[model samples]
Target: MNLLNTLKICVIAFLFTSLLNTTTQAQITPVLTHDDALKMILASKKHAELSDVLVNIAIVDAGANLKAFIRMDDSYLGSIDVAIKKAKTARYFNIDTGKLGELTQPGGIIYNIEHSNGGLITFPGGVPIKNKNGKIIGAIGVSGGTIEQDKSIALAGAKSLLN
Candidate 1:
């Protein structure tokens, strides 16, 4: 009788531990989906059209992997890589590239930091996408126009995820 009781308690504890682990895993945050990434690119394209600025847009997941990209007709070819770098930079740093640029000025604390991380685009146009809990899930980067224009378009893309 004593052996049976011990065995039963052990099984119950094992089941409880498994249940707790499952619940914890379920609470993990989800990454950006393809649908959300496409929506972001579309929003950025619309903004670029309205501003009459040809641009390249890139979106990366939480892991900084490219998920979606678009180059407007006549957009500069060089901007394709720039857009990707910007998105990666934003995700890696969890901050807008524009702000990062400021921090990398000659006399700034992170001077020349852009030379790191396989080359980062520390200028404007890279924005981190955050969830309702204020956690960053991805990033968007826009290039090909002026810095201001790129930043504007990128902001539009990032904001779309909020809605």
Candidate 2:
């Protein structure tokens, strides 16, 4: 009787585990790949004057590797570095670095995050790219324009993915 009971429990456990695995797989969302990031950037460019803007756009992977970067002619030399920094900041934080200033106030956890990441740029041009499930998988950064303009461009870029 004890052996039979043990067998029944094992079968029940197996069925329960199988059900959980199936549920988890059905709910899991795949992350955006590098190709997806590039397509989003291209779509955003159609809405803006890419050739006219003197700016740099950088796209980085979750690990902060540069997947795609573009610097228009006559853009500021420093904008490239700044754009990269912003992209890294977005990738690491999974949020816009523009909000870092507010989030890093005297009582905020992000306050010290700036000091932690040497290359993090707390500015308005960086936007985190999230998967359909809202998981951050990459980031894009723009520089060489006004902060507001940069933010607008970044938003345009991110919005392309969803819309």
Candidate 3:
């Protein structure tokens, strides 16, 4: 009878501990809200305006899902898909697209990788947005501008999360 009671107590303790751990893990996983994505898009637009360049901006969650997007007046229609691809590339790889571009060059480790994944923009315009814990929560991409301008604008958007 004592053994039975002890076994029951152990089982109950194990269940309680497992439940607590699951809750704690859920709380620690960061989720990027829609408002956060909007803030990033707006900030990127502001930066693009300052540069006198029209752009298409896109934000994607950590799962490479599009959350928000905008195309500035006079921006190229072709850039719409590019912007989304960049954001997805950054989020999927958890790395900036600029660096990914370099790594995908001829003789590089990931050469020809861009041709896969249905199409990816391995250029300087996508950046991952990481939480305070250094975990990537999402990414922002900018297009319809020079690579330099696109990169600058995307950086602005990614930095919005710091605030």
Candidate 4:
């Protein structure tokens, strides 16, 4: 009887685990593809080149996870992490990092928010990518240049999907 009971419990656990996996898979939303990431990177790099600046770029999907990255030759090594964080910050809040920086300023709303979210980049260079339905799909970030230049590059990347 004990052996039979144990076998029944094992079957029940297997069934439950299978059900959980199916539910998780069904709930997952569409994610940006590698080709999409490459398009963003190429557009951003072109913009940076036009500005005569090398930069590190990062792309993050809707879940705020890093999906792709590129570092131009001679780009600042320190900016690699900054670029990733900027992408994540934009995706996490569904807002551009530049705008978010404005809110994080001293005495402004959401001040010190940079201290949260495992460290955020509360500066320019991050832009959110949105679908035609106005749903945020991802974000892009560029670093290793002046804030304005970085923002210009990031904006180019963020708009790549439109074309």
Candidate 5:
């Protein structure tokens, strides 16, 4: 009789614990929306003279879905697609595509994944956005400016999230 009672209690405890685990796992990470992406790009325009270089900025969710994309007036036509690829690369690989190139080197494990995905760019202007727990939930990409300028804009966008 005691053994049966103990078994029943253990089973109940196990079921309760399983439910708690499921609940925790289902909690979605806070992700940036389309509005947030646009605000970041528009707000950063004042940081420097964007006249010479029209900027293209894009943001993608963790699943690599395009949340938003913006191209400044006079920006190059290709900048939009480039920015989207950059964002996809960052979000898919869970790291800045710029860093991936170096970290993966020729014949390296990550190197193999460089272009396998649908749309991924390894250029310098892409960056990943992480939550407080250090989990990447999205990415941002910037183009239309010089590589350095684009990188700066991407960094600024990420920093804007922090603030």
Candidate 6:
């Protein structure tokens, strides 16, 4: 009888622990809505317009999946792929693409890392989109402009979440 009671107590404890873990996981994993993606795109487009630069902007969710995209009128046709890869690259590694580029340079810590992951753009213009709590929820990538312009535009998009 004592053993039976002990086993029952253990099962109850395990169930309680599982419920708490599930609740904590749900709380930590925030949901990203379509409205959030549109906000980023609009902010990036506005910045690109101000800079007189035509570009393609891409957004990827935390899972490194494409969530949104915008190609400015007359933007470079080739930039569409570049923009998408930039967003994926940023979200996959959870770091800005420019910073990742530095690590992938010759003799760097992660040399040729870009050659992996079905091809990643390790250059500027990819910025990780973080929530107000500084948790990376997604990423933004801008292309069709100079590296500096792309980076600035991408930054503008990421900053939209904060504003």
Model 5, 49-152: lDDT tens per residue?
54355788888888988888777778789988999888888888787777876756777767656557764677689888775446787888888887788888
| lDDT (tens digit, per residue) of candidate 6 on 81-149 | 999999999989998899999999899999998888899999999989887657888889999999999
**What is the TM-score (0 to 1) of candidate 1?**
0.81
Between prediction 1 and prediction 4, which has the larger TM-score?
1
Model 6: which ten-residue window has the lowest total lDDT? Answer: 24-33
Candidate 3 lDDT at 162 equals 71
What are the C-alpha RMSDs, in order, of all predicted structures? 5.1, 5.4, 4.8, 9.1, 5.8, 5.6
Q: What are the models' TM-scores?
A: 0.81, 0.71, 0.81, 0.79, 0.71, 0.81
Each candidate's lDDT (Cα)?
0.92, 0.77, 0.91, 0.89, 0.76, 0.91
Which is the winner by lDDT between candidate 1 and candidate 6? 1
Please write out the lDDT profile of model 2 over residues 1-163, one tens digit for every residue.
6999999999999999999988875554356566667776675454447535667888887787888877777879999899888888888878887887578777886666677767578879998877656777778888888888777787787767665
Task: Write the residue-wise lDDT of candidate 4 on 1-163 in tens digits.
Answer: 6999999999999999999988865554346778889999999998888889999999999888888999999999999999999999988888878889998888999999989988999899998887645668899988999999999999998787767
Clashing pairs in 3: none
Candidate 4: Cα lDDT at 144: 96
Alpha carbon lDDT at 106, candidate 3: 93
lDDT of 1: 0.92
Candidate 5: lDDT of 59? 85
TM-score of 5: 0.71
Instruction: Give me the displacement of residue 1 in model 4, in angstroms.
Output: 72
lDDT, candidate 3, 6-53, per-residue tens: 999999999999999888666543888898899889999999998999
Best by lDDT: 1
lDDT of 5 at 93: 75
Kindly indicate the candidate among 2 and 4 with the higher TM-score.
Answer: 4
